[model samples]
Target: MPVYLDHNATAPVRPEAVRAMTDALNHVGNASSVHRFGRDARRRVEDARETVAALIGVQPGDLVFTSGGTEANNTALRGHGRTRTLVSAGEHEAVLQARPDAETVPLRSDGTVDLDALDVALAADDRPALVSVMLANNETGAINPVQQVVEIARRHGARVHCDAVQAPGKIAVDARALGVDLITVSSHKLGGPQGAGALAVLDGQSVAPLLAGGGQERKQRAGTENVPAIAGFGAAAEAALADLVRMTECAAWRDRLEAEARALCPRLQVHGAGAARLPNTSCLGLPGVRAETQVMALDLAGVAVSSGSACSSGKVHASHVLRAMGVSEDDADSAVRVSLGWTSTADDIDVFLDAWGKLVRRHGLAADAA
Candidate 1:
């Protein structure tokens, strides 16, 4: 059987989520309608809202459902009406492309956002500003000091938005505790259906509607909800919470994978090694082997992985996140991200390591010897 290690891109749908979605698909109703069927559908949607809200420590009423992480992020960035925006250089393209003109905050060599630079940028202008930072980076799995980011933004009267898409199942995420005005999360990242995501707006905070239509999502978003997908997302969130310990255990497997890989190739580099990272993720670089070449070789060996974010349209370009952390272009181009999830096992890691060892011996060592 092929071993899958690309959970950061998208995890295999959990059985609970699949069952929930199947049950919902058998029902027929519009959540917006007021009939008996409508009420039943609406109940499923509300139940899901409550479960998803609980996952991130928010009230059900504070959550607005959207298409996925991308829309949720756009809603938070554009709907907040902040004339000025500042995002970390290491953020996903969803935040970066949302406002191309937004000022960028540089990252430290460890891949975490530079808090001192953030303070200076926020102080640059008194214009209403929104600071967008991620809870955990998708590529390097680097965890940012969001509490400190919030503290700095608060001193400047700026609102904070955190794209927590990669953090839910891997680490503890508490929006209230983090003190951010807005937080975005996706279902697929947590083993749910891909079409569903939510944005948590703090009780006192307001974001203008990104989609205008008959009032839905408390007018923050306006579209007939995808009931089946929402149900699946809810089930996934509930399961993810219960599986937190399992995720923590996977950390040991991840560490071993890296340790063994490094033992085989002493020149192997682990990006963000000095920073606190998500337990399931490891960004490994073998000098002189391009990331795409390694990914293809692993696939041929029946072990699946990726070259950083899967959003790159099937092309393996140098990682922007690595460059932001001051990694040399050559190293950045050689790095591949291996992420584990609820379904991963020690056997999966061994298969990956076996494939990786061969790739390194065949190509990586040749370059080193040259």
Candidate 2:
């Protein structure tokens, strides 16, 4: 089997999630119905909510399920009645596109948001404003200084929203500790099924519905719940919660891949190396090779990796994240992202290193053995 090194893209669904979803599929009742079947279905949905909410450290009543992170982000951005929005340069497209007119905060060369720049942006505007910063970047896996962002925004009287879609199972993401008003999380990001995610709100904070249906999701969101997907999400959250204590162990795997690759190509540039990053992610630049070329070559070599965000549809564009961090377009295009996951193993790393070594040699950039 091909070594899949792109956990940041989407992880393979966990067996636990699959079983939960399949069992949910066998159920017969609209979660909105008032009968016994309906009540049972409702119980499952609520249980799932409680499970997921606990995993992210939010109150069950404060969470609202959405189709995915995109809708959750959109609800937070647009639902608040045209409030000014300021987002980091490295935020996912979900938040960036949620408000095109939203002001863009600059990033340091290492890809973390520039807090001083954020303070300036907030000061630049006097209107009721919202600040959207991510907990962890999807592309470079760089962890943002969200607590600092919160302090700055709070002093300036701005509401803070953190898109922590990539953070739940991989690190500690406490909503109360971070003290943000809103958080976005994705199920598939860890091991849950796709098509289901949530927007977590601080108590008393409200968001407008993107799709107003039949008063589902406590009227915070509408439409009947996708019980199967939601149940799967809950299962994934349970598993991820159990694994958090050991999540840092994955860093050794990421470090191994990075060190070996750099050893093979001494000039390699690992994006976000200058900042705090997730333990499972490494964004490596092969200098002269286009990211698309590297991705395609790696795929052919029985390894799967990506250029930047997996949010795109079959297109390999130069990374806007890297560009925002002041990397030249040439360097941005030459980088590829490799992310490890719960199932990643040493064998997987070996397969990746062999493939990457071949690519380095093919590009005439192989490192000299000392």
Candidate 3:
């Protein structure tokens, strides 16, 4: 069996979530109906909403359920009628592609947003604008200075939309404390079903509906609710909160893997090391070994990793995240991202280390292999 280390892409569903989803799947009700069954279904969704709300320190009524992080991001981006946007260069493609005409703010070498550039970018435009900045980067796992971003946006009369998909379970997230106008979070990133996510707004902050139908989600998101997925998301959210204290526990194994690799190849480069990154993630580069080669070799050796961000189609492409950080094409092509999660174990780290050793030796990068 392969040791699954690509948890940032998608974590295995937790047993608690599976049980919640299964129970909901066995029941019947349209959350929009006023009948008893509908009321029960609505209760389930609201309970789940409360759980997710607590995860991010927001009121339950402030969130609108969505299909996933991508939709939540797209909804937040286009939901606001602001004519222009200023997005960080290191953000996920969802934000980058959301407002194609939005001006870009360059990122620093450490993978954090350049607040100086953001101040300038926001001042460059006179019209009211929306500023989209992620709480944590999906590829590098570097935490962005959202509070600082908010301060800058306030100076320029811009609203802040933060993509906090990689945050809840890995860090202490309080949406209100961050003072962002909008926040987006996904369930699957923390061991829930894939199709469930939410777009949360700060209290009294309004967002235009992406879909207009029955007055579901306070008319912000319309459709029959996915009861099973939402229940699963709630269960996962509770569990994630319980597990948050253990988030940094995985760092020991991650650092061990990096130390082992560096011992073999002294030229190994670990990205985002100088910044406050997610405890579960590491993006590393082997000087001459291509990312594709390392990923395939690790798979063959019963370990799983990735070449930075995994596309929606499961294809490995050149990392826009690395490029945004001013990394060279060659260095970017040679980088791979390894992320751990709730299911990760030290034994899994051993499996990855063994595979990494052979790959480095085979690629003629093992100076310390002896």
Compared with the true structure, what per-residue lDDT tens digits does model 1 show for residues 294-332?
999999999889997888788888999999999999999
Q: By how many angstroms RMSD does model 3 differ from the true structure?
A: 1.1
Stretches of model 2 off by over 4 angstroms after superposition = none
Which candidate has the top score in lDDT?
1
Q: Candidate 1 at 290: error in angstroms?
A: 0.6
Of 1 and 3, the candidate ranking higher by lDDT? 1
Instruction: Estimate candidate 2's alpha-carbon lDDT, on a 0 to 1 scale.
Output: 0.90
Candidate 3 local lDDT, 61-154, one digit each (tens): 8999999998899998988889788899988888888779889999999999999999998888879899999999888889999999999999
Give the worst 10-residue stretch by lDDT in candidate 2: 361-370
TM-score of predicted model 1? 0.98
Off by over 4 Å in 3: none
Model 2 C-alpha lDDT per residue in residues 1-370, reported as the tens digit of each score: 8998888888889898999999989989889999999998898889899999998889999899889999999999888764688999898999989899999999999999999999998998888889999999988999999999999998888999999999989998899889899999999998999899999988787877888757898898888899899999999999999988776778988998899988999999999999999888899998989999999999999999998788888889899999998999999999999998988888999999998899899888997644
Q: What is the lDDT of candidate 1?
A: 0.93
Q: Which pairs of residues collide in candidate 1?
A: none
